[model samples]
Target: MALNNNRYSCPYICPSTHMQGEETKQQETAKIAVKPENILSAPYVPGNVRPRSPKVYPPGAPPKYLPQPTESTSGDILWMSPVGPWAAGHIDWSPQAGITGVRPVVDKYSITRYSTGEWRKNNQFTLTPRATDKAKALEAETQKDVANTFSNLDKKLNHSNEMLNDRIKELSYWKKQVQSTLNGITEELAAIEADRQRLKGACKILMLPEAISRECLELRTGRYEPDLVRDDAEQELIKEVAIVGEIRKIFNDTLIKAELQIEMIKSTKAAIERDWSDKEISLKIDNLNYTLTPDSNLILAHPGVTRWPENATTLEYWKHYCAESIRNCEDVRKMSAKLRADLMTSITKGGEDMKNQANRTNSALAETIDATEQMCEKLEDNLKDNLQKIADIENLIDYLKESLRNVQERNKCVMTRLHNRNYERPSVENCRDEAQYALMAEAKFIKESSESLQSKLREAESVRSELMKYRGELEKDIACKRKSLNIDKDRCARVRAHMPTPEEFAAG
Candidate 1:
């Protein structure tokens, strides 16, 4: 519709406009003029309402200017949309439109055309290609990441398998070492046991020799006095007794050593067995682990299986433990062997010593016996000589007695003659006559002879008594010597002969 210029006027004029009325009117005319280059033109339409000027207010009040719409400038009218298409349909700015009234005709084509163009420009040409490229790049990068992940996982799995295999081999090796040590310990234990038995046997054998030596000493005590001497045989017997005792003690000590060694070997064996047992279990576990795969039925999610054990040992410690155990076993075995050797040596040496001592004792006894026999023979000879001397002294005493008897008979005859002369010749004959003197001299000689004979007889009888006493002593000494010989040669020698052989002692 065309708008009339005279329909509305300015309510108030500027002072400059009044002062230059023609210029103002020209400017107003210019303001409403339309260029002919405008493309679309709307036809003018007549309205019943008369036009009027804009109202003016008092001073300081606002003055309102109303520009009249004109039909000639209708082509210059441009519809400026202030809202979106959806909202445009709900508004009507025409004077004939009411507050509640919406526009009867909607321009849906323009909005539809604009929307189609935006879809073609932004969606198809710009955003779609950019999004496609981004998706392709993301897919490629994801595929590469997946390939790297798979490769790393495969490498890790292979490394784990190799480690498991190595562990299995290590377990196998240690197991074998432990088994070998166990065997050595077992053998050592057996040897030690045997040694113990031998020691006990040796101890038993020593008893026989010790008892025999004591018994021989006891038997020698029965000797009679003067022949009961601590002879060579006795001394050797004492030595043999002492040696047997010492050998018994050695056997006992050796037995103790064997027992102790046996105990040590047993302990070592137990430790090796335990180590072997652990290795066996570990071997089985490692083998099972090696056999497992992703498809294995035994595979399960063992929670916390990756955690390390509290008592886990390092490889160095493990190797050291095995080596130390084997070394200990070797040491124990060596000790056992040494003990056995020493025991054998002791037994052999002991038996030889005892036998040698017994032989010595036997030799001494034999010498003592020979010496006793000689002594007894000498005593018997001395006894015979003493008896002979006693007999000769008795004969001398008898001879002296006969001489005394003769002297007594002569003295008696002389005294008878002297008595007859003294009576017949009286005093003169007693004074110094030749016949009287001769008779007195004869009497004196007879008295002297008788006194000498009595003295001889007494001396001879005392000599005979001494010789007889000497003969008795010699007889007693010979009997005592004979008794000692019998005791030593018969009783003690027989007892010593029963002494065990060196082989028997060693065997025990």
Candidate 2:
């Protein structure tokens, strides 16, 4: 690529492809406007549409339609083909391939100009041929279209990535909410289980046999005295407790399953987010503004090279843009599919929860009813035995009452006789003194029993207070430890979430 001696003569570096001579040597006269829009696929004049002047060039190199020759070299046009053999340079053509079948042109092939000619006075002649003007135009058009394409791509990728980030966050938030709800249900189930356990213990005691129950009370009270208790009340409480325990167990199982579901959904949601992020950034889309240099494709914009080369490269670039656009469109399609899948999964999970709730309710109710019925049947059998015992006790009470009446009559006669004879004889006085001493001994024994009972009661109360206070302290400690465990679990989860996925560091 040799340059003419005159540095300022050719504003264009000129295209590298060889030039063709036109037979119509006469200067072109028609004025044709080659708009920048006409050259590009789609014209996107960002800030302005100022069309710069067509750069000056030798009359032969520019397209016949661009700026016509404002000035001519006015020299004898040489006649010779371009320099080369088959592949290195030009080929021989007839005069028709020369200046419109009128004058021969000088090229690397040979000296086709047989006669010498007068040289131009001061004007410089171009030595370096250019590629076809159509090629240059097409190149320019491709550059502009590609630039716009890349610009749109930059914005598109950014917007898509932003949406991707938002979706990931939304999934995380939704997962957190689900987990929170799951935790609540789990706590409720635990509380219900504790309550059921306490009730179960109480119910077991209530269903104890009457003799055993009396023993238990007497052992605790240190007394043989009996208080009336109803078999019907105990049976009713047993039935209620059995039913409640069955229901509580059912709820506990259901909540356990629900907690598992929350964990499953959280894991699945995280995978979805990770996969989407990978797919979105897989193209290295974030680096498009730097990696995609549309400016580099602007061969037409190179100094003084606007009207030279032409080929299928323009159409090729067009195809490339279309392909890139399709890829982006596919990304959008996949994103939509992902969102749709998420929606369907949510709806499905909701339906499953409803089903689980209904199933749990039915199972709890049915099991509770069965337990209650079984308990009540056992209680009925016990009640029948208790009733027979009651009848026997009633007969014994009647006989005892008759004996007490006879004894009371005899005792009244004796007391009257004693009262009349007392204080007159030495034997009567001795009996009266002995009876008063026996009464004093009985009073002293009763006071001792009362004091012993009072001491026992105080000891029992003190023990109960101490146990209650210790239980409260233990519960508080347990609550604090549970809170710390939850905080640690959350911290661990956050750390895991911050970890990168496989996509972040993979090579292109």
Candidate 3:
């Protein structure tokens, strides 16, 4: 076969083929027959340009170009890198291509050691399968554990959610109960407060009747002399003042009780309201907890939050506490109702009593005024009759005086006639005569008549003086009665008219 001179040539040809003559032929045959370890250098070639063959070809098979190597080595080509895509960019490997009987460089030694270590590690026959199987089993176990963990988390979350829902429901129930109690207590407090106000109003109203009673008593003090005596009207007025005072005291006491009761009711209401407020907040908190989820943005890590409170109450204690609060509210409500009822009773009775006493006082005043007016009228009539008797006595005394004067003149004329007769008839006339005897008897009779007339005049004048003194007393007494009537009937009665009605007192 002819050798072609090309630098890019097949590296399968031996270098001894370049010799001439029989020696050349002999070298060629020797080279061809060379053992694997005795082969020399070969040239580099690319994998795609020159495909490799597994076995060597004998001489005279085909003509081909071959590369002349610049150097040679004495070694068999134990192995060559196969030409393929994997061998691209690698140093072309041919027969007898490696270093021959020389120590490798440090980098080559390092590469060889590294490659040997990799091979040895890959060829761990005993440990690889077992270890691989264990790793695979671990992977499977990890996957299963993860799946189980997820499942458990889901179950636990569901359970916790259900518990939160139940808790929320419980809170809601208690909230409703607390709210009801709060409402009841609130209403009771309002009623008690209103009753207290009414009591205050009633007390204020009582002042009017009390003032009237006191005023009436004061007016009675203005009565004159005999009228100032404690008559039925005066006695009734005094009693009215006492009664009004007593009623006022009772109202004040009732008002104090009402105020105290109102405060108690208000306190109870406040407690119930506080309980209700707590329940409302708890309900909201529980509802929020029930609504929460692991994915919720509101969720956060609260360390140690799951711990139970040391002061937490048990179910029985909780129920008892709730029930006790409601019971307390109910008790307070009942108390408020009873208090209001009692207040109502007090108002009614007090009002009626006040009105009745006022009426009695008014009636007594009216009767006393009528009696005074009648007494005044009778006194005036007696004064008129006494005056008429005084005038008739004065006329009778004048007539007695005139008659006594005429008798005196007649006695004087008789005496003068007797004296003239005695002087004119001397001793004969002085002798015991019928004219002298008649004159003497006439004088004696005149003297006795004058004395009797004078006695009658003195008796008449004494009687007239007594009657005039009695008339003056009567007139004075009548004036006093009139004054008393004016004070009682006119002034005090007008003040009594201002008394509040029973309905007004009750309303108060």
Point to the candidate with the largest lDDT: 3
Clashing pairs in 1: 2-44, 3-70, 7-51
Instruction: Give lDDT tens digits, candidate 1, residues 273-346.
Output: 88888889889988998888777888878788888899998989999998998888888788888988998888
Candidate ranking under lDDT, highest first, comes to: 3, 1, 2
TM-score, candidate number 3? 0.54
| lDDT by residue for model 3 (184-300), tens | 788777777777777788888888887887887887787776777888887887888788788888878888888888778877878888888888888888888887877899987
True-structure lDDT of candidate 2: 0.40
TM-score to true structure, per model: 0.46, 0.20, 0.54
Instruction: For candidate 2, give the lDDT of residue 369.
Output: 40
Pick by TM-score: 1 or 3, better one: 3
User: Who wins the TM-score comparison?
Assistant: 3
Q: What's the ranking of the predictions by TM-score, best on top?
A: 3, 1, 2
Q: How many clashes does the backbone of model 2 have?
A: 16
Off by over 4 Å in 3: 1-162, 293-296, 380-475
Cα shift from native, residue 319, model 1 (Å):
1.5
